[model samples]
Target chain A: MSDFLFKRMTLIGIGLLGSSIALAARQKGLVEHIAIHTRSQATLARAEELSLGDSYHKDVADSVKDADLVIVCTPVGACEAVAKAIAPYLAEGAIVTDVGSVKASIIRQMQPYLPKTVHFIPGHPIAGTEQSGPDSGFAELFINRWCILTPPEGTDAAAVDKLAQFWTVLGSNVETMDANHHDHVLAITSHLPHLIAYNIVGTASDLEMVTNSEVIKYSAGGFRDSTRLAASDPTMWRDVFLHNKEATLEMLGRFTEDLTALQRAIRWGDGDTLYELFSRTRSIRRSIIDAGQEVDASDFGRHIVEGGETRAEQLKSDDHKDTGS
Target chain B: MSDFLFKRMTLIGIGLLGSSIALAARQKGLVEHIAIHTRSQATLARAEELSLGDSYHKDVADSVKDADLVIVCTPVGACEAVAKAIAPYLAEGAIVTDVGSVKASIIRQMQPYLPKTVHFIPGHPIAGTEQSGPDSGFAELFINRWCILTPPEGTDAAAVDKLAQFWTVLGSNVETMDANHHDHVLAITSHLPHLIAYNIVGTASDLEMVTNSEVIKYSAGGFRDSTRLAASDPTMWRDVFLHNKEATLEMLGRFTEDLTALQRAIRWGDGDTLYELFSRTRSIRRSIIDAGQEVDASDFGRHIVEGGETRAEQLKSDDHKDTGS
Candidate 1:
């Protein structure tokens, strides 16, 4: 795995995902020379301070020049400008990819601007934290996470393989799916969840009956979990909704319809409907845990117990102590 | 704290909350004897096996006999019946309280049945995990969490203080507020968040274009967090929504209106509106962390780190190595 290497790798943004790529690539020795570019000079300086890349460039063209792999890590709205800026500077036969949340729009945005000689593979690592900036990234950010690649039909198979291998070396399991299917899947899994979280937190904040302080204090009751997704980068999520409008809106429509039905059930005291839905959703959480997407923790595993006992172990200890008594 | 003692404490339902009270009371020596009773024989057997109380009774009358303190830990919908059954058996001057989420509704349902000789305090502990069972009980479940007590006007202050002291010894911070206000606060803080979680997961599960496996696989992108709340006990949540109908419906209405506004923003490509709401929600997460309700861990502290280093420590180590390099 250590033999996997690229002569030069370019990243176009230095936010959480971008800096994470830099850190993971560096730690894994996937790229010998890393070139970084960001639109903001302050961010570029921050990346330079963190030494996230071997070289820092103010211009996207300069960053991609002679690079074997160029990963555009900007917000989805900026995909076209970045693609156009680096199109001429990209080396022949270089692999051009992205880490954007939306795949279809990214392909539509960058396909026309990119050179025919380059292998344009759009990829998204289904991983992130709420924090942003170069300082927030770690080498292990992508460990055991999924990275989906959406290469257009008739694209070079060898190019797709190379990009998949790159993500593999960075500790992500790679899968390839059609761009449209990827958009729909992500709309339900990522975009819709984030939108609901942001909306709920916003709704709670605007409540005249519940003070902001009370909301914060009693957040562990459940509201705080939604806040994690709501706290994501506003610019990135805004672009995601804008670029993936059709799919996002479709999912949001379904969500709103379901929510309305649930509202009626609550209003009508239809406990059976609420209970059935709640019971069914519980299995989904179990499936997620079994599928290795979520940790099998009780209450997000926040117990400060010594010896690092897991929730299950803690429960067992309670039973043991009770029986002993 | 060790001096605090109730001669006999009766727990009417030996589920998650009932068993937890038994464990915590015993752990802190807050009660000399605990009498446990549950209508379901299976649950009662399980509670008795766990030694959750000093004595287990098949009948509610037997359990509450001569009990100086009686805590009803049944679902909100069952409060009136449990109050009725125990009213005949409660010792004079007994401090009778409940752990129902909807305080106003519980007060309404139980106030008439509970004798004036017994001080009835309707209360809610703003703490729980998705898991619920007799086996899930632990002494530390309430540590640093808020417990709200809503006693009727002219109720015995001494009894209320005694109950508060009991909860304080069991590791909770107690506050007294009006029953209606408690219902309103809980509707936003707990009930509505849960309903939204259950609704979104239900929506995702019923998606025509996306398969259930796909939603489960890519859930780490954000969907999995919501599933935690959705995985909570169905029976408990059904009662919560039914008992807290007015406040729950009010909050749900606001949520739907805000969600509609957000949907319109997404449809019209209103980036500023999306960004503003997203930014405002981010600070609430920070406030939750600052208020000690949630950790500052990225992704609700659900990282699967093998080396036992926390996410923050791992990020720091990356920076340390980078600067050293």
Candidate 2:
């Protein structure tokens, strides 16, 4: 009879993910009430200022007391402590989930503390911008993005479906997979890319021959792309690499090995190898565009967004005018 | 009394840069007449269809005949052949320049064949999208972008000034530097970032553990940023790496060294080192935005372009509405 998925939803951390979930859930009327709790009192105060929740609590236990759904939105490293703090307070039959990048480690960190009365499903919404904090979140951040849920074996089907429906209404395409597979997949798709981006930005800044001003001024030439990822939250990314160590290192190793081969090709003037690899990689982006994961516009559509017209749009208009000519 | 920068301007290749120069020059009325030439007749025909130039030539020498300015816009590898082809036909006292990524190599490849009667100034505009070819250009591509000109010393200062004025009128801030210095600056800013992007995309696609579809579907995490750069023209990138071997290799070495250290930090669970580097790199992107090299909007303003409202704009509107509430 009730349209609400949960009578009360408790968000344990009020960072980008937590605040976004708050804004999205409230905007969609998916929950009757949101009880917010954060380790930092300042963040809690900020959440209240933004009206991100119906009730704000400095005590984690107080926040989860009557919640039928509890979401931990913290750095992967903080999962254990959050689970330990909120475990005794979570209502019977409540659904417990997280929005961490790594799934297996999250399960390992929180599983021991969580009571068997609640259905524990770990989820990672594969969505974010480089910016972080409560002020940086929005209701539409998850629109058309993928939210991957990794529930342990024998979890209640109804609970999982309810969570999936909740995310669906929040404007995400949800996929359920094994915890380990989610980690492995994300290690390549997200973690490795962030690592490489941060690494390259660090290298560019430390260069003595090229001044930092030069690097920043001419960043439009490919380097600025990496800077977006490199500008991600240090604390969150640090926890990601540390928690997802095995898979991150595995993908990173492959990346470095491929990079070494590319270096050799550049050194030996092997245009064929460079051309072959470069050509092959171009199609992957096209596939990403076709798959609806990336915008098809050139330069991520920055020019269109800034200038009000892309070259493709201009060409289309030009063709129309040429018909009369 | 005429306002034209040149009576006739010849473009030696009709790709992204060449076609863009033609469009921008024509739109700005910088030149009286434009001559376009390319090795591929198909591309030449495309340029003609687009009305990119007043004249189209299948023969490179014919394109340069009676031209007061010649811009070779082919891949750096073809600079030598282009120089040799246009040398005899180039008008006396003409300004010969190139839009190559690598300056020193462009000079080496082009200066020998260019006659003393011409002023050879090598220029690189730090502006482009991933798209290529005649259709992928627009008149506004050079606006607010930096164009570096590396004119050899002891050349006619007036000629260099004339060329600088041309770029200035084309909506570029022109800076003059030595060819070697130009190579070093671009090596870090453009070449290295591209190589890393191409390398990582290759690594992601070749992984046996992760399917290509998974990478494509979930690329919004971070990998999609790299794909934009990886989707660039292979022939042009190959020529860039091959032409700027020394500086590219040097930057690659530094990047690898830094990456290895970051890897060690991750491997050893050294969160401080990771945190420090990640936090420091965040400021560089901000500086780039401040310097007008990158869009200040989150996610490169993709959401604003697509949805017509960014989160920041939404927050501002929300604040105004909350004043009375």
Candidate 3:
């Protein structure tokens, strides 16, 4: 076991990301001493209450005084302030990273504030849920999920490798990319999907003809799925959009344009076009299933829809005839 | 038990809707014998393989003979043909209903072909799975869902009452409404949601910049939900749009206008408008929960994003709760 890879790990903003790291670290035995800190005394106290760390502090300098690693886990908008707050605190030779959803902006915001001796490696874990706070995280949230790290030029390779190991122990499939590319990919994969969900749910709620009760009652599977993303922590998401405005806007532009094409197709009464488009989309669902990220939950999850046969039956036939269909 | 409300029930299509009715009727003992008929031999055989009915026939006329109730369960496009085929052989005083999604057009197409001896009532069951065919249904699929009945003027009260009781026995909440209005309401709530889901999935699949693996690997709760709706049977949905064109087009127009406004807001970085709209939608999810129609599957049956009530409890007292206060 590469357990106790670090003697001490300091965390800022003991919220979802921070607490999840703590749990994963403990379970994986990655570090000996977990130092949890937050700007709010209340949050710090809550993290302590949750037993999320061996040490809790509201002062970053003192918290990082003897730490071997420090991870900033705040809303993207607060990176600068946190970087400033902890600049003097990040220890020499220590690798400092973040678990923000937006990468480029945080790198820009934190680079200037970091001490020269500390290695600043920015990361965005492409994982989360509709909930937030210290209590909302688990050791398994990052399992099989992607974590992209954007290290600046001249960053120490050994330090980057160590941080990557930490995330890998936490069950992340790590990808190293430039900060810009990280933002761009996330804009399409994570950020824009979230924005669209929130927008559609908002649109549905505002409709005069469809009462709120009706939307809820007949939400079926479609609306329910949209709402899961829509139900995400609002403050965290709002800050993400604000921080990653350019990338998010670019993706949103593409999505809206595609949607407009669909609108036009519907307006023209083009059944062939609509059918073709609908058919193409159905295949993506199969791809998602093949990747093991999702299963066919069907509507209402009332029943698992697959026949649970074909392949197994094929194997049986192969054994019986040593021969073919 | 009000079971055997019909002496013999004939279902003209052995797909999802038709199969569901067979299972529900069998479970509730709602009819003496279920007579299944479809256009294809394969489906008829599969229905037999699934024990979907006590009686089976390939021809509609032979299937409906001596039946006390007939359900035109084929695609909406086939309703007129099914009606024409079954009308001459139906027993006197039989009540005919359809499980088509679009009510107005189904009534228009089938009403003229039906014999005056049989009562004609059209219905839309606001419940389904992404799966189709005889083997895809269960007895409990209709539980706690809705069935909307659209009957033309002077349609017998006795006939409507009997159909409502049948749906009620199947564990659905039955509501009577005008055919046109049923189509309009469903256009937004059902049709549009499915269309948008299919469209977005298709759009995402076509993007040259995003790999299928990337979309699937990070496919979160949102995409999974959308895909479930998108994966619905193609022929059924194609006919739905083709049949319910006017109302769906009208609702699609409204959705497009709203979406465009949202696009503009995002482009201008209008956080207030975006936040306001987002905040409003959360209430709809709550209502859905209250109505017992949905569960919060945010962790999505994977890792519980966080265990327990810690996150939700914290949000109630969240500092941002005072934002804009």
Candidate 4:
């Protein structure tokens, strides 16, 4: 949102992704007018008091009446309902998009509800954190990350390009792919890793030997990394699995097979095989760092807490003492 | 090592852990003289060049003569060989110990070679990075980590107490457990994590659908964390598995079963199960942060590149283009 990409931009969720889009839009002057909407009145009030938008509404239909652009930023499960709620009031020729993680499901759910006049493009900014809520976002969240657009077979090329430009303004590198490929890629890169983190942390925490204090004290770098992934918003992740079930199951199958091979290697005392696998994996990390997608410092995770610290200030605002920041 | 814990110390193999022990011992003035010996003459020369020890020797027996404390820091496979190399020359009142990860294996391998007159204790300072060789050693590596000591039933209490004090001085909290239990806990806590990391990275790297570059570019926090664990030293980890085979196999069993359960949850769209697992894991991370082992922040894995930036200066040395920073 480096300039006025849209005169009136409407964010139809006002959660972490939506609030972040609003923040980045305002900071970069991408939009002249911002309309924030959420189903909860308390959340809408919280967003308003925090100056998240120039206009606020509890109903999606009320908020997107004349919006030049409407960005859906709710959980995938809620996207279809919100789309249905807002479609009747959507301005003709309005560009509609979302920031959901799973493209296929969100598109499958929301596209049918929107008017054919509105460009219903599905895009996912490959960026986020474990923390959620309106206050837990920043303008730089999408910086240097990928914003992938998974448009259906008959998507309007002009509309998709316009949406891509919008993400580009937010400092994201854009890529175009079919919804299925996008889902498959994300399953391996994002969803599976998250499941592993959540699974291992759950397992370790439940262990009698590695109690809360012991695991906490002994976590070191590797375990700490897993915790961050594991700490992600539970509701968001649950919806992701529910919506993107097929791709996730496929990725899980592959992961289980790989893990089983490794278990056998260890059981059989295959030292050379273990060494080779361990060595190869190290190279992938180096490649990631070289590709500029990752950092080599220990404090990448610390930035989340720092961002959250800034967000905790929202607690001081009377409007959001209980609702949100 | 504070206030001269020993007059002379002997290290049988000067690899990462051995060299780290030397550095930590010297940094705290734990020993007046450090006698370094390794089977590899080149390693001994490198240690001398780094000034890691007061004296360096190719022969383990020649190095340990008259030393008050003898520490074998070779791979577990080399323990018996190194013990026999230094056995005939060990002083009657000298203390002999090792920093091997597996206590039972090391005890079985080395105890027979040493004289009963000397106090023999088996210890593993639960520390280290993926890097290896003498140059990778640092004084702070053991700080805030656990050092599990598995002394035998009839081991001298005074000797064990003194070694515990030594580890405490090195900034490691001393935790004594039976050899079997220590191996089991570590198997679950460290070994299994590393194995999983290696396997996942290997799987991703080998994927036909995903290019390595794509995986590298979109890695995010989850993948980077796994890579860090995967990047751990191959030889050392190989030795650990070979030595601690049974415990590792047992832990692997639990992990595999748990992972299969998670896979099923994801496949069936079991939101409640996924949420519970994700929620429980989240708390473990928070606890880890409370324990000062992790930074409770977003994208903790993103720091890897920032580390590389500082390493950019170090990388100046990589091309043999040392500009002498």
- The chain B TM-scores of all candidates, as shown, are 0.94, 0.96, 0.91, 0.89
Instruction: Put the candidates in DockQ order, highest first.
Output: 2, 1, 3, 4
Model 3 CA deviation exceeding 4 Å by range: A300-325, B1-3, B300-325
Off by over 4 Å in 4: A1-3, A40-50, A208-212, A298-325, B301-325
Evaluate candidate 3 and give its CAPRI docking class based on DockQ.
Answer: acceptable
TM-score of candidate 3 against the unseen true structure: 0.89
Taking the tens digit of each residue's C-alpha lDDT, what string does model 4 give over B1-325?
Answer: 4469898999888876888799889988899999998877777888898899999887677899999898888778888888787788888878898887788888889889888888888998877655567765667777777888899889999989988988999989988888887777777667777777777888888888877777777776356667767766677777888888888777677776787887788777787887777666756665665665654334452322233112112211112210100
lDDT of 2 by residue, B222-302 (tens): 999999889888899999999999999999999989989988998999999999998898889888888888876788877
Q: How would you encode candidate 1's per-residue C-alpha lDDT over A1-325 as one tens digit per residue? A: 3464688999988888888899889888788899999988888888898788889998788889999999988889999988888898899999999999999999999999888999999999999877777777777778788999999999999899989988999888999999999999999999999999999999999988889998888776788888888988888899999999999999999998998998899889899999899888878987887777766556666653222324344542213211100
Residue B10, candidate 1: alpha-carbon lDDT: 93
A best-first ranking of the candidates according to their TM-score comes to: 2, 1, 3, 4
Backbone clash count, each prediction separately: 0, 0, 2, 16
TM-score of 4: 0.88
**Weakest lDDT window of 10 consecutive positions for candidate 1 chain A:** A316-325
- The candidate that achieves the highest lDDT relative to the unseen native structure: 2
Which candidate ranks first by DockQ, i.e. highest?
2
CAPRI class of candidate 1: medium
Residue B137 shift from truth in candidate 3, angstroms? 1.4
Q: lDDT of each structure?
A: 0.84, 0.88, 0.74, 0.74
Best by TM-score: 2
TM-score of chain B of 2: 0.96
